[model samples]
Target: MEDKRAAVTALPALFADLVRCETRLYNALNDRLREQHGLTTAQYEILRYLHDHPEARVADLATEFAAGVGAISKGIDRMENLGWVERRPNPTDRRSSLLALSHNGSDLFDAAQKTFTTRLTELLADLPALTTVARTLAHLRTTLEDRRIGLPAG
Candidate 1:
């Protein structure tokens, strides 16, 4: 038991390292996006979502992003005011409306996407074993999301 504990001494700190990495990456991306396109990373992601999933509702975005509906609605309001996205009556529901990107939004997304990709690429260029890390993180994300803890040993 003593040897096992010693062997895994670094395991406890892995979560901290993961969080630090996420924070650094997010800040870097956000800064780059804002400087280059006058958009925050979150705003860019919302535009990206609208670009890909046209006619989606606020609830759909909230669920897709794991955010609150009110927060998503507020974000939509801001984007609508910016002329980046627009809402039309939801054909399927009276209480809800569908969202789509405006022409300007599409154009901005394309330009910002290039900056985002370039910055992300530059940041990740020094990282090793990208594929392995990505796969492991994906599995861990799914495991955590499914709440698969404290299960049967088998």
Candidate 2:
């Protein structure tokens, strides 16, 4: 354990740890969300965003989630088919439609949010310095988002 700890103390090792941790967390969350709410993580995220940004368009969601518009649109189509979301013509942009959560979507999101938090807490239960790590990650995420490095140009 001491040797392993020493190995991960370096920057590259820490980055590898971060990547693996993210993958594990995402897979667990995706599985749980799918089993409980019929939502993949990506779909749940779209619903969550629509809940917050009631007037979002596909482009807006793609931008917010760092996904391509085509991918976002397909997810939206699935949710809309499930009666979890609806698209209304964007008055401002004829080519894009504004996305909103349906009544079912809002209810599902409310329930799923509880599951998400509970599962996340369970997953992090034994981890040390969770608060500090969360804060640091938030800062990193904000900085990366602002820089938009490695992202495709719009």
Candidate 3:
């Protein structure tokens, strides 16, 4: 009972530590991505997603990013202007359009993916329990998705 109480009391601090770690990692990655590829972390994420799931709609990206539809639309607009993405008329929905990576986008994503992977590997290689930590995080992410509990749309 005492151990249970102590563990429960420690939850908030543990959660905060998790958030801190995530923020630091994201910041570092974002800086490297911006410098090496002229891409923001968010932009890279969108491109990466589209590469894996071509012809996705704005709503799909919004849901994946846990962001607002309007925000995703604005980002898509910017990417389109930069020739990183292209929008085609959605066959089933006249009001919506399908998004896919442009040639430039594909090239950029390929390079960015390599850089991202290398940087991530370098960062984690020194961590002795990296595999265990990764598994734990994956389980947490799956549980969150299963419970439909996500970060609020930005």
Candidate 4:
């Protein structure tokens, strides 16, 4: 009773702290990327994912990114305009298209990847415990997924 109440009382504080940290980190990273490469964080992430999974279809990519179709479509349109990706008609599924990283996209990724890696590395270099951070973030993601919170309703 009292013990459970005490534990519950502490949970909000812990959760708030974790959320604040994650939000700050995300904003900072996005800002840095925008400053350096003129890309929004979401755009960069999408490009990276497409670069890695060139065979992924548009719907699959939207799901993988936990983003809405409209959002992904907008991003893809922008990427296409930037010559970073191309949409090819999926032979198996004529209705939906396959999104693949273009040659220029690959080249851009190769050129920017090192700088992105270096920046991320620098950000994490002074972290107190890398493993703990990874584990905590993984736990948070799993919890969110399990609760069906913050994810697009399929």
Candidate 5:
């Protein structure tokens, strides 16, 4: 027997609270990286991808990031300007360029990887309901991926 007016007020608050919670987590993680290594979340993502795929091209990175070529190019330009990445001509395509982590980039990525893994483990260790939370998130991710691929859940 809740009043519709009361329920309407609560809905917006609940949605806003969820958004704020997500933003807070992203900011906290970003601040940790900024403090420890002066790297942004986006930069870290690109570096990690390049490290894994070594010599990945701009087109591939663009597709993987789901960003436009200009956005990926801008990120690469910034990373390259900082000596964290390098781009060489693609052997098969004159118009495309391949990106790879430079020595400095690899060193930085290795350090950040350890730091992120350690901190995340520590964070999870202190949580009482982490197992349930992780399972729920995994299930949600799988559901979303399946939907994206046009597969019906049985």
Candidate 6:
């Protein structure tokens, strides 16, 4: 009975630590991307995803990013205005367009990739248990994704 109570108390603290760590890492990465590439972390993520998955629709991106369609649409709009992404007609679905990285967007993503790697390396260099922690986090993320837990439905 005592062991069960201890395990329950420890689990929430572990989750809280995970959340705090994620927030810090996100903020740091965002700051570096903003400073070096004039892009937010979210924008970089979108561009990177589009680069790898060409012709993905906004809904697809929203699902991948665990964001709402409206939010993804707005981000795509801003990127479109900046000529970072181009919307092409989806031959199969006329109502939904496909997103592709523009020439400039591809260039920016390449640069941002270097910045992201460098910044992340610097931030995580001191963590001796990075591999174990990363594996745990990956498992957690996969579990959450499988369950669709806490994610907004598109």
Candidates in order have lDDT scores of 0.88, 0.88, 0.92, 0.81, 0.81, 0.94
Q: Alpha carbon lDDT of residue 100, candidate 6?
A: 99
Tens digit per residue, CA lDDT, model 1, 83-131: 9899999878999999999999999999999998899999997789998
Clashing pairs in 5: none
Clashes of each: 0, 0, 0, 0, 0, 0
TM-score of candidate 6 to 2 decimals: 0.94
| Model 5 TM-score relative to the real fold | 0.71
lDDT for each residue of candidate 5 in 23-118, tens digit (9 for 90 to 100): 776676677778899897788889889999988998788766657778789889999999999999999999988899999999999988876677
Please report the TM-score between candidate 1 and the true structure: 0.85
lDDT preference between candidates 1 and 3, better one: 3
lDDT of 2: 0.88
Better of 2 and 3 by TM-score: 3
Q: Per-residue alpha-carbon lDDT of model 3 for 51-103, expressed as tens digits?
A: 99999999999878777899999999999999999999999999999999999
**What's the residue-level lDDT of 130 in candidate 2?**
83
CA displacement after TM-score superposition, residue 92 of candidate 1 (Å): 0.7
Task: Give me the overall lDDT of model 6.
Answer: 0.94
lDDT of 4: 0.81
C-alpha RMSD (angstroms) for model 1: 5.1
Per-residue accuracy of model 4 over 1-154 as CA lDDT, tens digit each: 9999999999999989888976876777788777877776677777788888887776777777777887788888899999988999999988888888899888777766766777778778788999898998899788877886776765
Compared with the true structure, model 3 gives a TM-score of 0.93
For model 5 the local lDDT of residue 47 reads 89
Better of 1 and 2 by TM-score: 2
